[model samples]
Target: MKFIALFAGLPLLAAAAPTQRALGMPLQGDLCMPFQHDLGTPLQGGDFTAFAWFEHEPIHPPIQARGLRFWVGGEPATYCPSPPVVHCPPGKVTAFSGGGYGLSVMVPGGQRVYVSPTGELGYTQAHSAYIPPGSFLGPFEYTPGIPFGHYTFNGKGFIACPNSKEGPTTWKVFAHIPNAIVPTSDIQDCLPFQAVTEIFGSPPAAWQYT
Candidate 1:
């Protein structure tokens, strides 16, 4: 049961400039423009991968958090949308019954983040992980106006384990900023994990056309 890539051809919408309050500073075009990044393969013990991008929203009232979208393999995880569960063992019951996988996060600001597998994955409780009280579970905070910065998201994903009795294995998940080195202390101590959305910055040149 390998996952497919469903977001391969989505259109890239134009984004507007960030407000002074959003970046804490100002001096350029949209710093946090809608962007996408490849969430390389799972750490070292999983069979699935993911990718993410920001769905741009009109600048007004200032969106509390940018809408982030995630596409796991090609189909949504059991915790996500209508896709059936991937690779569930013959006689084991899954922790979650929606059919996709489950994604949970521990960002700053004491925010409890839960990512539902609705084909497109986003924060259910806190829309965006931007703000002092709500860091994206990493080493950076969301500074208004300065929409460009790196951060890490720590969480877990329940997926099928190839050679184990654990029907839907729980793997530690980490989404990090590009080239960002996660301190050993920041690492979550959990098993059967996978990481997604590696780097988030400006949209790639290739996305300019879409």
Candidate 2:
């Protein structure tokens, strides 16, 4: 079950390098902006290949988003959205290049983040979403007005693995019934894993409009 993205069309970089970003309600005034980031796992010593971007397809501005990607990291893992006053913001989810209300895709998860009664952790993708109820965003290591930075998702940073190979991984990411169950039959997979958003700076090399 390959996941659909929020915004589509933006050409992808080599792999999480530049030209993509997230889409959230951004923090106010000289704080942070959405940019490409790595879903770093401190446990693995940050080795494995897991990246995330706001628009999974990496579409440029002047249009709506195609979709979003989490856990597996799309083609070019990282991305760069529009300006805060224009589009992507600190810890935000960008839906387009230059800022506009666009489509926000839901992978297999529900609209909100939750944990199932059977122990399955559920999450979703949106243009403007709040951190979990009690969970607050970590800190801002951004350069005041920069389009890149880092932060902690606290409890929401948790993720799971699946029984299948790269194919099954997509199932786990999309889940079944939105806030339903994510199966894990692999021992080496879904083993109490978590990650942090590690971002690099946004540059002109990041995006191009169609």
Candidate 3:
């Protein structure tokens, strides 16, 4: 099944970048604002997409999320009152993007970064919480006060491949950042980009958002 985003009010404008300390590390594309509300979905193997504004430009092409890809392995993913899960083919399940909030960031150094309404919240361990939770976002909430920036690439970085099951699933979140060049901030607000959000995951299904 294909996924679709159902927003309520008008889109909020971008805010000044947050302090570096609150940022944790350098961010990419743009600094994303937190989702003050619940952005959830009721489908497995579907798609969710949203467009946000940046104070500057991105470093790679945005993602083109489309189509029914993977089988979340259980009931449809949900959020709001609780978190959601992005199940794999079988018992090995993980949550992709579904929480009370959303965030954006860059990788490696800073050559490229990302901004996503979908908060990729990874596995919940007894220790720290894993970001980019393992799947793509379903219902994305946008707000003002978000920051935006590009990456510089300090050294080598990680990329996701369809064959690497052990690789990080958060790649689905950053899939919209400019990976090769830079994206101008002159795109439409509600339209994600003049470009489309692309797909990232195995067989390209996990990252598929139509």
Candidate 4:
């Protein structure tokens, strides 16, 4: 990026400080922008809050069936008891924040969101897929900068769920992770999606969160 400035009455041009962000990626690039249905828009340039969610089927040992949202594992599960959450995403929480490189994603308490070196999908690189303030942003509004989590370390495998149980399953952020199967018991509003076929192996029967 370049900038214009006046040095002692002379017009001088200088380069802006370089940073990694998700934007201006080639259409065929591994990392792509995510779109949200509730907001009726896709993410814009610059950093912003992102509330992650997806449906939870009872296949991970058969507990209960319901939708789940991305909340910090050490803090609390995503809940809508009365109000929305208030904490902020930590500073310099990169990883998928750029098309080429990413910093690192750390929660408010201190734990970090671990990603695979190959940038495919991973859950056990450390312990859990549960991390905090998992927001996708461009950081640089002008350059459309995307970070590593958006793509991968190698800039090849555009970060996605390869198969069953690769961890934090995602085929790609298809309009918000399989529509966050919300439990009827939870009074929170569930984002709606049009389901033509797969509910991620869960039967269409209604279930509750335990």
Candidate 5:
């Protein structure tokens, strides 16, 4: 699996320059580029939106089913924090616990969907599966850019990208994590993989601004 060159033939943005920003959940890491998707034929000329739906149950006592829905584009949607925080910054990405297992995108024709690599994208890291259920954590703040790598929550991992690059779009999962289990339908979109680069040190050279 090889990744399309993220910085190929692109100008790097200055570090100090203000990046174009949009309000949404903050992802765990930076975005990757040249992201490929298998959501059927591309839209002719109209804009489309992506969405992800997640569900799982906690392992602790008194387990309960939890779910979350996230959207990329369309009419403005309301995001009310579970507990209204009075001092959240203007651009803060709200964080949360309990991750999601299923993923889907709403394109022009209909919704394109995908389940977790193994089972469900879990929340905490104390699980027995490759992708722990309850792993769909975070509403962290993120600025849009070319899809990049992902972040870890308590050692559990999930790829993070802008709403546009979510669902039906994936890098080489097996290449990065050799034992990773991917659905046959998603394999077509997994090739040309790029080695995952940690964004905690520094941001990538190129990214598409919102």
Candidate 6:
């Protein structure tokens, strides 16, 4: 399928400083612009993040995906609560309770939610389909101005920037590897495409911080 440009919010990478940082991921190209979802207006202190993994020989222009991995602080994610309140998602605690981190999982066509207390984000070089059950791969740390995780596959993932970007509203996608499934013949069918939704702070007092 032909690719379509996703235009949302203020372009972060567009600011274009004198020089661009090296994308540590396998792909040796400049970082594409920071991505934002059209769901809401651009809020300060929060920026949408993603990355592009240039395909190996044969495929041109590269591909990217949201390398999503759910983590709550230092542990893996669990099923969201049935009622699914804003502060906590059912039983899962991917982050701290108050002023902590909340996560929503979106698989190919399904969704899962988790909460965290460590303010940590989860990302994996491995795809959700590839991840085995009963595995807890620690949280993915963020390096200011650089991609988040290691370089592996074309998959891309982002952490929700719910709070004030002033203090720690950071989100990024790092680690890009070529997809083994999609061959040169199918690169066109596997171009990067992602739709992510992140809601920070519940309301009222939450609005002030978010």
- Best-fitting candidate, scored by TM-score: 2
Given candidate 1, what's the lDDT at residue 34? Answer: 27
lDDT of 5 by residue, 1-210 (tens): 111233123222223322122212222333222222433433221111112111111110101112222221122211222344433222112121111111111111222112233422222111112333322223222222233222222223232222123444322222122223444433233321111111222111111101
Query: Every model's Cα RMSD, please?
Result: 18.5, 15.0, 16.6, 20.6, 18.5, 15.7
CA error at residue 113 for candidate 3, angstroms? 22
Which lDDT values do the candidates have, in the order given? Answer: 0.22, 0.27, 0.22, 0.21, 0.23, 0.24
Query: lDDT tens string, model 4, 157-196?
Result: 1211212232342222121222222233221222211111
State the displacement of the C-alpha of residue 187, model 4, in Å, after optimal TM-score superposition.
Answer: 40
Instruction: Kindly provide the TM-score of model 1 when superposed on the true structure, using C-alpha atoms.
Output: 0.19
Residue 151 CA error for candidate 5 (Å)?
Answer: 6.6
Clashes of each: 28, 33, 34, 21, 28, 22
Which regions in candidate 1 have their CA more than 4 angstroms from the true location? 1-5, 13-111, 114-140, 145-173, 177-210
Error of 4 at 113 (Å): 3.7
**Best by the lDDT measure:** 2
Better of 4 and 6 by lDDT: 6
TM-score of each model, paired residue for residue = 0.19, 0.27, 0.19, 0.21, 0.24, 0.26
- Candidate 2 regions exceeding 4 Å error are 1-69, 74-151, 154-156, 163-180, 184-189, 203-210
Q: Choose 2 or 6, whichever is better by lDDT.
A: 2
Runs off by more than 4 Å, candidate 4: 1-107, 117-152, 157-159, 162-210
Candidate 3 minimal-lDDT segment of 10 residues: 103-112
1-210 per-residue lDDT for model 6 (tens digits): 111222223222222221222322232333223222232332122222223322221111111122343211122234323343445323222221111111223222122111112222233321232323332222222222332222111133322222222343222221222321221222222322121222223321110100
lDDT of 2 by residue, 16-132 (tens): 333223322222233122232222421111111122333333322111111232333323222345454344222223221111011122222212332333333332343334333
Candidate 1 — worst ten consecutive residues by lDDT sum?
A: 91-100
Error of 6 at 143 (Å): 1.5
